[model samples]
Target chain A: MKRRWRQLIYLLTATAAALFMFLPAAAETPVEKGLAIAREADARDTGFRDSTVNLLMILRNRHGQESIRRMRIRTLEVEGDGDKILNIFDSPRDVRGTALLTYTHKFGDDDQWLYLPALKRVKRISSRNKSGSFMGSEFAYEDIASQEVEKYTYKWIRDEVYDGLECFVIERYPLDRKNSGYRRQMIWIDKKEYRTLKVDYYDRKDSLLKTLTLTGYRKYNNRFWRASGMNMVNHQNGKSTRLEFSDYRFGVGLRDSDFSRNSLKRVR
Target chain B: MGRPAYASAAVPLALVLLLVFFVSRSQACDLSGHASVEGRFFFRDALFPGQEGNSASVALQPEFYHGRRDGSGLTFTPFARFDSADPERSRFDIRELNYLMLGDHWELTVGISRVFWGVTEFVHLADIINQTDYVEDMDGEDKLGQPMIHLSMPRDWGVVDMFVLPYFRERTFPGEKGRLRTQPVVDTDRAVYESAAKEYHVDLALRYSHTAGIWDFGIYYFRGTGREPDFLLSADSSGKPVLVPFYVQIGQTGLDVQAVLGNWLFKLESIYRTSRDRNFFAGAGGFEYSMVNAASSGVDAGLIAEWAYDERGEDASTPFDNDVVLGIRLALNDAAGTEALIGISRDLDGGDSMLSLESGRRIGEAWKIALDAFFVIGSSEGDALHALRADDNVQVRLSYYF
Candidate 1:
């Protein structure tokens, strides 16, 4: 009996020593881990040009009623810190020779240009408000473009489970002093892929304003993850906007020369 | 090859309905509406040309509404003005009384509203019906108050709207101590010289909007004549015209399109109008009646490239119409409404160009103060400037919003 007790005590001591060595490491805060994961994911694909196609439908509320109006478009994206996006329309209303180009920067301001086929002219657009709805739709101009890491000051909030996967919740606040439609945003980043699965936006008064969801992430190139669709629902206005991205191709020989102001005039 | 900016009324009523439902409900019900008062106390620098005059004006703008935004709301807005520079111009203006449904997509509004029309360097929309031209210093003229009805629906697929503005009444009250000139009336084109006793008028418009791909197309049509009141005419004691109606139109039609794809933006607009009789200073009779048949069409396109010095760039909340515009606008963080804009434009006619510099600052969030100094370079005969018979006009203005 004494020998058995001695053996049990010895086993207990070894188990306690092993746990003592691993507990502190397992107790790392979610915020620190989330930030590190996001940083690493952003670094993996820092520079690339992508081409995509999308089917667009603008549903307007006329007299409080809704309907679906269809449109198709092709897009070219050059991502740095901010993203440079160009969209060309196809099908419906026969606006065959129209082009829209947007250059979005991370810390500075964004710029837009349009080419008209009938007049053969190009115009430059200013980027003053990123919060204003895009083309009167629920999605703002800022919502459609690239989201840089520096636009907001992030704080790690907590760890939670979403869609059966572990996630880190982070709060992001705009560093800008301009009047904003929202105050802060809470995002849920997946721990595994670092994909943003959901976001809750607060208004200037810190009231919950809107919710955005990114769904259907598909793994690309064995390491890259991309969201197939995104949706934003305005809590105050009871309106929602959805974006579907398709036919994405990566690593095209797109150059900065393709994104010049003079190119707006020559767009076909 | 495209429709003019002033095409037929293609804005659907559904769009207005959506707008009424969403915008009115965005803010929780407070007092429904509020009152705003503002004045511009200008101290003219006598050393400057054309600006050697000082002026002060006091204005009382009140807005009132009844009923909850969820169901039935009726809003009324009225304005009263007193000016030291023009004591003869003391007046009261009825801005609007717009009514909307609780949860539906429809609204009925009565009073004066700016009609959505025209696209030059700036945007001019219908239903923005307050007058601050002399103070704001923009070139576009003002249309006087008229009893009207407006309806709209704000949605995504398409929008429809309709409006009827009646110019039925014009009764000038005698000044507290002076005789009233024949209750002034503006007759089509004849407003330049002759003054009429009072006349009836009517304006009706319809608009439709639809989205196809990245393109938004709006078609609109407006028909009316002799709706501008004579009291507001910029004329001298002898009725020597201080300004002439630039277009000869008893009726006008327009079409406009807005498209966006990536970084490229395109806008196409076209307009046509019916000819009317006009009065001009022909050197002999001071003014003579002449039939003028004319129409003008213009288009503007632009492109811009945006780049960032750092990987993590910035995001902003303000919207600047950079497409088709060539200039720089700077706004300081500490100054909420303060901004400086420097602009240059190459005229579509390949004739003469224009340059404008403007600045606006706010004393507070609710009050905005602005100054505009404009210069037109390479002016030629028949240019926009020479056509308007004006040059280098400077203006300063202040506005308060509730």
Candidate 2:
């Protein structure tokens, strides 16, 4: 009777160990968890047909000298692909009336065109410089673009509390390793709204290069959440760029025709 | 004297009328302007007999717009420049004085404006709408605004633009005191027009542009007075050999295409021009590849190469016939907006070559400094640049915006 009881206990212990070993693999891996989180975040942000917003960009140097630039942005979200964005500068006098138009794709290279008011011409630009600073600002071109899910592969990091909000930390590695300047990026998303609160960018050398923090969340249309301010700080250069967004208008009924090159000349 | 007096009085009268119109619709009108002072100093001695060593200039451009959100608007941009070295270089232009109305799929614009069309970097073979304002710069980028009525219609396949240009303006020429000039001075007063209508000739242009994925393509057809004037050597009133500009009517078919792939951009501009004097084809094709954030230093560098060809070869008008150009561009991606470019063009026929360097950076908030250098080597007697071979020099320009 004693031997039979010991054998039953051993069988229970072995089964418990086996379940512990296979549970995480069968339920969810780190990659699966990360992708699921990203998918959820992206799904929540969809259905915004079009939006227009006014932006004020403040650039500060190491010496704390600041220069302000005012611009307006119009964006249209494509159902299955990426987004189309138009940025028009209004102030700083020298760059006034300059406009940049971009059409991003899900898989391949994006398209960009720049309109110079002084020249009264539109120039097609190469969009492979995703890591280059945008208009001499600390924000790289890739940073301002819509973050497509397929552009990067993800790994779920541990969760942590940031700014008194429970957040999930995820690390993403760019799929286009050769073109991207960043090796990986760590993103902190809040648990309640899945809104991105902070991001740490690592350069190709796997060194921390910049940190981007977003704050001042304002809900619009009772469904869409827009950040009022975004601050990017370069760790190596001690320079920073801050974007303050205001006057957001959504669902303006903008069509694909409005984003054509012909409209670029007619944009006010 | 009568014409000058009338012209001088007409400017102020028009200004007063515009001001009155804006003041009457104060709620819809917005006024903005910028004034700039520039100085150009030559590093070498004067190339021509009457040329100066340095010059100073001031320019004022004021833009006024009255419009609504629905794309109905009137815009007026009046530009004026005053140069100390050459009176011919100083002039006034209505860069854009147009009334635009936009509909669901069509747009109409009436009045004077500027239009540019091209894809290549070295030469703008497809750009023919506006006459080159040569006195403003040697790169042929500056243009004299054209008076026209334009209509554009966008369709699923492409966008079509039609232009009806009336009342042509004569091209301005540099004075004898200017540095870059031909051996014989150009006599603008003796300008000849092939059409009996002269400046009243009606010109027309049609263009179609489309973008498909990575490629952008455009085809344009223009039937009008040629912007480039044929030089006829004649005796001036001073009994000296002078070049008379003879404007001729011509038909031009132009094609411009650009393909963006990865970090490379390929551009091409080709044009076929037919006129009473001659029929010829010219083209420029180039490619540029950029290395983004080279070595992770926050700098971008682009390497460019282009080939320019003309059927007329040595008899071609400009210096870009059968030439190869290689250039490099550097962007410092800094707060000061620093950019530098260097290019060298080699003539395949005569071994003559030209090298150019341009660099610019902004200072403080509203100030900009630019440096430009041009050098020529081994310009044979039959080469087009032989006349200006000795004119190699550098110039420094400082400008204050607004």
Off by over 4 Å in 1: A1-268, B1-52, B86-90, B102-105, B115-120, B123-136, B141-145, B153-157, B168-199, B226-249, B276-326, B331-337, B345-354, B364-367, B376-402
lDDT of 1 by residue, B249-307 (tens): 24545566655544334545544434354321100000111111101001111222221
TM-score of 2: 0.94
RMSD each, Å: 19.8, 3.1
Tens digits of per-residue lDDT for model 2, B1-402: 001122245754585487568747668777777776666655667666777767788888888888877868888888898988887778887778778898998999987788889887767789988878877777778887787899999999998999999867677777777766676867777888999988779999999999998899999999989988889999977688888988899999999999999899999999999999789999999999988888878898999999999998998778989999999999998887899999999999889999888898888777778888888866988787887776786767666666
Model 2 chain B weakest lDDT span, ten residues long: B1-10
Which candidate has the highest DockQ of all?
2
Off by over 4 Å in 2: A1-26, B1-20
lDDT, model 2, position A115: 88
Lowest summed lDDT window (length 10), candidate 1 chain B: B281-290
Provide the clashing-pair count of each candidate structure. Answer: 108, 0
